[model samples]
Target: MIVRCLEIIHPDGDYPVAEFDGIRVGGVYPVLEMVTDDDHCYIRVLGPDSPDPGLEWDPVSFETVDTRIPPGWTLAIAGGRTRLADARWQRPGFWTDYYRGDPQARADYDHVKSELLAAAPPREN
Candidate 1:
């Protein structure tokens, strides 16, 4: 997914951070994934200098530019072997080792993975 920054609201309390990291108003960013809690949604996107699992930002600050799911992505429920805070849209292989030693969970994961692949759109040559 892609998003464009709509605004930058500064932190109010005595928070350690005082800036929006690398996020800028009007700047477009590629979202790695989105997570939600009881009341708010957070998007994970790369900062100007952060690598890999990037920083999570409030979804209210950005506008959705695209909602297309990338190839090889799958939804992971937060349970069993998964350590996610909530259900997540994640890249393939994100479940590695999480199901280890649990036959039923592993089987369930394999089944879901197969179904996801089968439902994916065909790749262009």
Candidate 2:
């Protein structure tokens, strides 16, 4: 499975770092290959089942990381069907890459992580 890096510029200047299974891609919010050159930074409302199961079709906005490759910067991007826009999973805190484990998967669904978690059914005491 190919994992794409999502370039997100947090409005508060806190960028979403690129991570796969909790492994940093050398830098915070690094450019990923799965992101096509044609892709531009904008907010898109994803549909239901777009990200994962149990996630309702609630509109989630995101900033696409449009990176211009530097003259001497070389990076490896794992290829997969995943995209920045598709990053919005059906459930908050749900990761598309299940193989990576819970922490990593949840890390991928950063956009609505808080929302999803909050939306989740309260734990039983």
Candidate number of the best TM-score: 1
For model 2, residues 10-79, the per-residue Cα lDDT tens digits are 3445656443222223322222222233433222222222243222111122223333432222332234
TM-score per candidate, chains pooled: 0.53, 0.19
Query: Over 4 Å off in model 2, which ranges?
Result: 1-34, 37-45, 51-99, 107-125
In candidate 1, stretches whose alpha carbon ends up further than 4 angstroms from where it belongs are: 12-19, 79-125
Pairs clashing within candidate 2: 2-79, 2-80, 51-89, 52-90, 55-90, 55-91
Score each candidate by Cα lDDT. 0.54, 0.32
For model 1 the TM-score comes to 0.53
lDDT of 1 at 45: 61
